[model samples]
Target: MQGIIDRQLDVLIYPEIGMDPMSVQLASLRLAPVQVATWGHPETTGLPTIDYYLSAEELEPPRAQENYTEQLITLPNLGCFYRPWGGEAIRLDLGKLGIDPRSPLLLCPGMPFKYARQHDWVFAEIARRLGRCQFVFFIPEVTNLAEALRRRLEAVFAQYGLNFDEYVIFIPWLNGPAFDGLLERADVFLDTIGFSGFNTAMQAVEQGSPIVTREGRFLRGRLASGILKRIGLQELIAGSEEDYISLAVKLIRDGEYRDRVRKRIETERHVLFEDMAPIRALENFLAKVAN
Candidate 1:
């Protein structure tokens, strides 16, 4: 088999989790002088050749950092890596989605079946509590493997007597203009906890949708909490299942609190997108490694 020729590469950056060991082994053998870095927290590769592990301010120091042998370089709070839409773009048309904008409540379930984030029960429970309000779910097309796993998830939903066809309103995945349109339609984005929704949660917040997240253990749980706190939305971070439910209920029922969070997010949107501190730090680190 052919090998990685070191002369062709200067640096290697792994963006997501789950790296193949063979790739690491091959890279180490040929790319010795080349720098390698990992981002998005998959714990460690246990490879001696990896030069650095990249993290964010949300990740607690010495914990995620301590577990890995590579030097840890922390990225400044980039808010969330979501594309932002201008304030003028936020539309108030829940009616088109078969929902009333004034309808006391709306639940934004951003869970994908592959991650075992079966929040069907939580949605149903919230619906039961809210009574008159509506719960909206974004149903994405499941991969074949995800579909197989979804059967078990469906059973859990059925046990609660919640039918997917009845509760979930389909919102096709959008990009560019369409994606902005979808974000403008929702009020609050409910984050998943069993495994958290990292990218989606940030996108929701960026588009002026307030995010309500439940804290969990390790990387997944801490991500949204970390981002919200950094952005001064700490009040929106819910710590338990009951807290999740209560916050959802309060955000819907209490007009004052809901308005406060909504306005705060709107005020912070520009600061989040234009902030260059994180970008500068990342560039500086990259330049140092490249040198």
Candidate 2:
């Protein structure tokens, strides 16, 4: 680390951290390396070694950067990391999963546990509104701390009188192939706030399920709104909690709107893959770094 700083490296890329004493040591020397942070929350470290915090337009002026530091450089819309399963290629055996294709299956890819607490309430309300409808929730494998948090969330569900066994069927995480199968069996995909499921949402949409999401201040929240808007499904994007619940309830109750969203998503699935915005941004970023 000392040698790299002494040599004045072109760039140094690393993930975000809360606070590391070593960063203070590095910053004291006034290192000129261009630091880039990715994947985690778009925040600042207030370290002088850190020259730039890289992030998408959605996360522009990352919360930490806004409140703590001014080292953020907002990138153009680089798009999400995951792609939806192309609708035409997805196939499923509903009977094997004990799901009846004839019955409405509301598929929520993963529980909103981390930052989106509203999902807990939204999903519970969804279960209440669509009583007895088969709702399949795919629970992701969380680590030690995250697992503990998930347990607390589950307890909250019970407190709200939501019977996980009756309304929701918990499915273990699967590999790509198995996940695709689940998507095929699902009738609709639900999104969380402050950060939508980019890959999961796209897969659900591609698999012919209409995705319903709420917009928020950050990129994590605005993803669904942006994608739906881009693909001409703006009507499916909810503006608030009430709007999200109303849309979900309407989709479950109004056959015409539900079918229309489904068909429209299927018809427009290709556009997401073919879109050039993400590609161009990636190319530009790579070029800048290379130079």
**Among all candidates shown, the one with the greatest TM-score:** 1
TM-score of 2: 0.73
Clashing pairs in 2: 84-202, 84-203, 194-220, 194-221, 195-220, 195-221
The positional error of residue 161 in candidate 2, measured at the CA in angstroms, is 5.4
lDDT of each: 0.62, 0.63
TM-score of each: 0.76, 0.73
Angstrom error of the Cα, residue 153, model 2: value is 6.4
Per-residue lDDT for 1-291 in model 1, tens only? 143453456666666435566555564553635445555544665667777877766744346666667787777774234445544443536666665666553545554542444554666577667665655655566545445434655565577666644444444444555455566565557777655666676666766677788876555466667767767888888877788888888887777887788788877656556567767887888788877
RMSD of 2: 4.7
The Cα error of candidate 1 at residue 268, in Å, is 2.1
**In model 1, where is the ten-residue run with the lowest total lDDT?**
78-87
Give the C-alpha lDDT of model 2: 0.63
Best by lDDT: 2
